[model samples]
Target: MSMGSCDINALKLMKKGSVPGMDMAGTVMKCSTGMWKEGDRVCGMLLGGLSSTIVDKKMLDRYGMQGSCATYCRTQCDMICKVPETMPFEEACCMPCCMMMSFQAFNLKTWPYSNKSHEPILVLGAGTSLGLMTCQLGSMMGYKIMAVCEMTEMADVMSFGAEKTFDCNDPQIVEKIMKATQNALTMAMDCSSTDSSLAIAAKCMGSSGGTICCFPLMMMSAGGKTEELMTMDDDSKMETMMEKTMGINMHNIKIVRKLPTTMFGFDAEMMGCMFKPMPDETKHAHAFLKTFSTWMAEGKMKVLPSQMAQNQGMKNLILCMEECKSGGSKMMCKRLVCAMGETGPSV
Candidate 1:
């Protein structure tokens, strides 16, 4: 494929004979690897469903189906991955998207969280993938951490970085957070988009305010109840700041969207090849696509607390997608492996 083309545009080019050997998977099947020969294990995010086989969806291999999934470049919002061997393809799949957004919000260099000497900075969903990384990253940078998530996951979450834990479902969660921070807590990264959690983040943020960093994955599921959680029409929960013309604090801690370009950019058709020529970038490529896998192997990053399965492949994918609409916790780090599959993502 010419470096000038990307995603579906490249697919169009392939059909037109301008590009050759372009598999529907969105990668040039016949590109010269230079030193790395064919059949070597390379990890990447496919555009296909992780539940059933991509072949079931169409006729392509599972990985190819994801690469070639209907998510043409225009629809994909610039997320992509090329599989690497040392890294399990499953874990690496969504990291591009998660890391790209989270690192921006939690950039230790720029927006450092408070340490033990100061009030602990809270990550609302520290058990999830972004929360876990925020945990490690915050720990690496010396931030006093508190993770609010499922009761069962608290031990692992605390191991990551949090010093405290609480149930997200508790009605008095804000009061609990207040107690945790000695009523001085202000900064928080609300990784989950459940309206209630957002409300909790705002209420706990002091009147003077603190930063509210939200991942805004409005497309993934938090749990089986994500649809109900996000679709709730509650008025008393998240207040619209009519004064600032924005909901939630209006102007207190700055609210910025964390566009995860780094994660999505790796397999992104636009810039994936741009860094290929840099000799030193070998490590970057390895690090970029494989960070999740590496972390999983090291156990610093853990998977979801349960082994869940989808039975109907794409059909279940559509059925399960409803919860994602409100955006719950699907973005966590645990590799949701297809229980039946032998290679790549489950289905």
Candidate 2:
């Protein structure tokens, strides 16, 4: 199983003893449907996957947590996709959450292939797994990618398909991006979703404006207001504060907040709020998974760099989780995988 930002969030917010995994790659032990048989190699995503017991959709719906860090896990047949024999289980596990979210972001906008335009797409936090996936996918679709990342990650981000790169630490990052794009940048994906990142993305848009896709729920305060009044739901106040914060006209730029949970057809409860499910999103997600599986089989998709956990079992998994939570240079642009039982190699 591979760790992701969602798993990190689970560590911070979930109740005690709750499992914390969302991506998994392993062989099927049993199946009720003929579509999948015993020993078929597959990988998928679910709410929580780190437990010893089987975690299915029902458990996720009831407890809002299910994980795949266990030696065994159970998910709906439709949730999985076949992993090619050529791909390592560690690499395949990185796709379900991060890659799926990247695909959804591009699908939300017009596809670059359909238009055949080389318009630039800015990716903030390009060093992140999701950001790297977005850059690669956008480039594959023929869009020019402009990325913002740490200096150490610039080369890797470029190799993934970003044509231009800017240092996030640079005080003049917004100006640099604007200058490079001739102040005509139209589209962007903000992986960070922080207040400063959002402001920079808005300011970097062209005079005609464009869309900024944000991966997290936006909560920005104006003055000393309470947190409740800062949600995106409060459009009037949000727009006013955003306009002031970003130093741009809010009417021109469209801010889109998309959560990956919608793809599962379940209301996502986060930070004490419930997000309704969108069936259409689930349909799109299935389609993308099918296409991605094909891509994997054809060796068209490149997997992200991964680090295997030092040991195996739940103790090692907990250590890996803590390392991820602590945050360091070692975790950047890499997925941490923990092998369960004796199935895979021990790092």
Candidate 3:
């Protein structure tokens, strides 16, 4: 039941003294019965490869323990959520499920756009795996995108569907974004989940009420920016600042903390979340997988780029995590993959 991969967001929470309970998939390779034979494989997500496979025996021997459970899992990688079989195993494994999570988080039911084409969304951390997928999905949904990341990521983010890319570290970032979007930006997702990133996103959101999404949040924190926004939670306090500078209605800002996995009823209890996926959540997830697979097969949707640590295999997983932390622009907009055994990558 442990995962063979780790989720970077969960790792962040662990660093903050909060225990993360989800962001994992279950594999039974370790059971005494050995449901897995010598050649069998398990499917799961790595912190870097949201889509991946691993050898049952090795996965069991290495990651199947309570202490390491949150960071790794074992799986067969046979489900519809996996990447297209035709693509290289390393590049395809991380995007499928991550795409699904990004799609699910959008909750089309709550989307207020009358015509998606007219709305432009600002995606912070556009170089991260989640941001890359969000850009693709938003494009698919017909929204013009303004992605925020390092200037070096502009070309890559544009290929993924961003209309414009801004350097997040720019002191005049807000001014640049407003000009780029012509102040039409109505929604945003701060995939970076940092104070400065959220502030920039807030500045880009138009004066009218709009939604801004962030990730890896507790149920309660979902409603607004983290304390870094300061007393801005009080609409009156933020009104003067946001209104004069960004033309935003302080009271109109709606912060939606995105908890992608648990929204699908994926181990809420163990993940330490309050809400369970509604009965219809699974139906929707499956629907997404089915539709996503078809789109992939038809060459409509794109799989985010990924890197293979081919020589190292599972032993290199730790390196993948470190890459996420320090890889910077070089690591932007791509996933990292490591093979498990001889082959058997579900394709």
Reference-based TM-score of each model: 0.53, 0.85, 0.67
Task: Identify the runs in model 2 with alpha carbons over 4 angstroms from their true place.
Answer: 49-65, 107-115, 217-237, 245-248, 344-347
Give all candidates' CA lDDT scores.
Answer: 0.43, 0.71, 0.53
lDDT digits (tens) for residues 155-239 of candidate 3: 8788888988888788989999888888767788776666557667776777675777765431122234444333343324434
Clashes of 3: 16
- RMSD (Å) per prediction: 11.0, 4.6, 8.1
Candidate 1 residue runs with Cα over 4 Å from true position = 1-40, 44-100, 107-119, 127-130, 183-186, 206-208, 219-251, 261-300, 303-335, 339-342, 345-347
Task: State the weakest 10-residue window (summed lDDT) of model 2.
Answer: 217-226
Worst 10-residue stretch by lDDT in candidate 3? 46-55
The alpha-carbon deviation from the true structure for residue 174 of candidate 3, after best TM-score superposition, in angstroms, is: 2.0
Model 1 collision count? 31
Clashing residue pair totals per candidate (backbone < 3 A)? 31, 8, 16
